[model samples]
Target chain A: SAVISQKPSRDICQRGTSLTIQCQVDSQVTMMFWYRQQPGQSLTLIATANQGSEATYESGFVIDKFPISRPNLTFSTLTVSNMSPEDSSIYLCSVGQGTEKLFFGSGTQLSVL
Target chain B: AQTVTQSQPEMSVQEAETVTLSCTYDTSESDYYLFWYKQPPSRQMILVIRQEAYKQQNATENRFSVNFQKAAKSFSLKISDSQLGDAAMYFCAYRRVNSGYALNFGKGTSLLVTP
Candidate 1:
């Protein structure tokens, strides 16, 4: 089991501003994942952060909008640049191996005006 | 690509009664895993149960159990003697084995427990 601590449990931001969300894991892990949950919707993978390597993003997501930084095995950060109302969602960080088991942080809820 | 589906949007159960949440998935691969997660009003996601595709026996944890029908591609969660704490949003998720991929989750079903 892994313990993840995420900051800014909830935040309200204005349009065009950027917010950086941080995730810290209790144990060292090779990969960390970021996800987004829109209002009344399920979770969608935003990107996968690998230590010392560039983050891998899923289709329909771009790095310029959601830049990720993985400095070490236990820590990572995701920045939502140029926020918009559509960007309002719950951003979560998780660490784990494949399908076995995944542990999640408390999640950062962002509401953009 | 894999997809998970949960048909019920909401369910109501009397306290101490039994209720089942339905889930189905589409996947060509034979080896995989399925899980049921619970999210309370606090929005804390909790793992309720999991079933391996290869296992024939159903997985049970105290009052929570799973009915996994591999052939039908259906995995359902059954909660016996439901409590007030059981009221929450239930999500069904699927993961492929050995792929090291992220989970595919359903839209989720909201459960309401009545007194």
Candidate 2:
């Protein structure tokens, strides 16, 4: 199992401000992903972060809103741009070595005011 | 596209009792994986158990076990000796064999374990 550390466990920001969440993995991983979960809702895939390429955004999500950076195998970041109350959700970072199971971080709880 | 379904929105069980949460999924692929994740008040998603589609034998972890019915596309989790700590929201997920590690999650079932 991979251990992931997510910074800014939580934050409250003014509307229209951008917040960046960071995820660090204890070990190098090949695949990293970002997900969003609304309060009392299921997890929604936001994007897949590739080490050296642009992230792949899922349907209903756009790169302009959630920009991702995977500088290396051990780290990745997700930025929630132009935030709004609707952008308030728990952001999760997951790492997978291959087609195996994914390990998730504690998640960053964001609240837009 | 694959979808996971957890029909029970909420369920309750007494401490030391057994409880089962139902889950069904839709997938055209023959090889895949299923997982059950528990999220407590802390909001950390914890893996409870997982089942491989090609495996006929069920998977068990301590008091957590799963009933994987491949033909029926059903995977249910059974918690034996339920404890207060078992109270949490459980999500069912599916991952295709060929697809990258992205998992499709169900709405989730809130389980309450009471003494």
Candidate 3:
């Protein structure tokens, strides 16, 4: 089991601004993923953050909009740049070991006005 | 690509009663995993139960259990003696085993426990 702490549990930001959400894990995980969830919607995978290598983003997502950095095994950060009203959503970080089950962080809620 | 579907948008159950949340998924791969996650008012996601595709028997955890139908590509979560704390949004997710891909999630079903 891994304990993930996400900072800025909830934040209200202005449009065009950027917000960086931090995720810290208690143990070294084999893989870490970032996800976004709109209000009342299912979770969407944003990117997969791996140590040493650059983050692998999913389709419809770009690095210029969402930049991710995994400095170490236990820490990672995701920045939502040039936020728009549509960018308002809850971002979550998840980690998986060898099991199929993945543990998630509490999530960071960002509201763009 | 994998996709998950949860037919019911909202469901209600009386306190201490049993409730089942239905879910179905489409995947080309034969080996995969299914999971049920709970999200409370706080919006924190929590795992409720999980089932491996190869496992023939159902998976049970405490009062929570799953009915995994591999042939039908259906996985449902059953909560026995539902409590107030059990009232929340439930999501069904699917992922391929050993694929290292992101999980595919359903829209979710909101469960409301009535007094």
Q: Identify the candidate with maximal DockQ.
A: 2
Q: Model 3, B64-90: lDDT tens per residue?
A: 999999999999999999999999999
Encode model 1's per-residue lDDT on A1-113: one tens digit a residue. Answer: 78899988899999999999999998898668999989898889899997898899999999999999999999999999999899999998988844477778889999999
Find the candidate with the highest lDDT and give its number. 2
User: Candidate 2 lDDT, tens digit per residue, B1-115?
Assistant: 8999999999999999999999999999999999999999888888888888999999999999999999999999999999999999999999998778899999999999999
List each candidate's DockQ score: 0.57, 0.79, 0.72
Candidate 1 global lDDT:
0.90
Look at candidate 2 and tell me the lDDT of residue B99.
79
Question: DockQ for model 2?
Answer: 0.79
Using all chains and alpha carbons, the TM-scores for the candidates as numbered come to 0.96, 0.97, 0.98
Q: Clashing residue pairs in candidate 1, if any?
A: none
Candidate lDDT scores, in order, read: 0.90, 0.94, 0.93
State which candidate, 2 or 3, has the greater DockQ. 2
lDDT of 1 by residue, B17-72 (tens): 99999999999998998989888766656778888899999989999999999999
lDDT at A69 for candidate 3?
98
Candidate 3 or 1, higher TM-score: 3
Off by over 4 Å in 1: A97-99
Q: What is the TM-score of chain B alone in each candidate?
A: 0.97, 0.98, 0.97
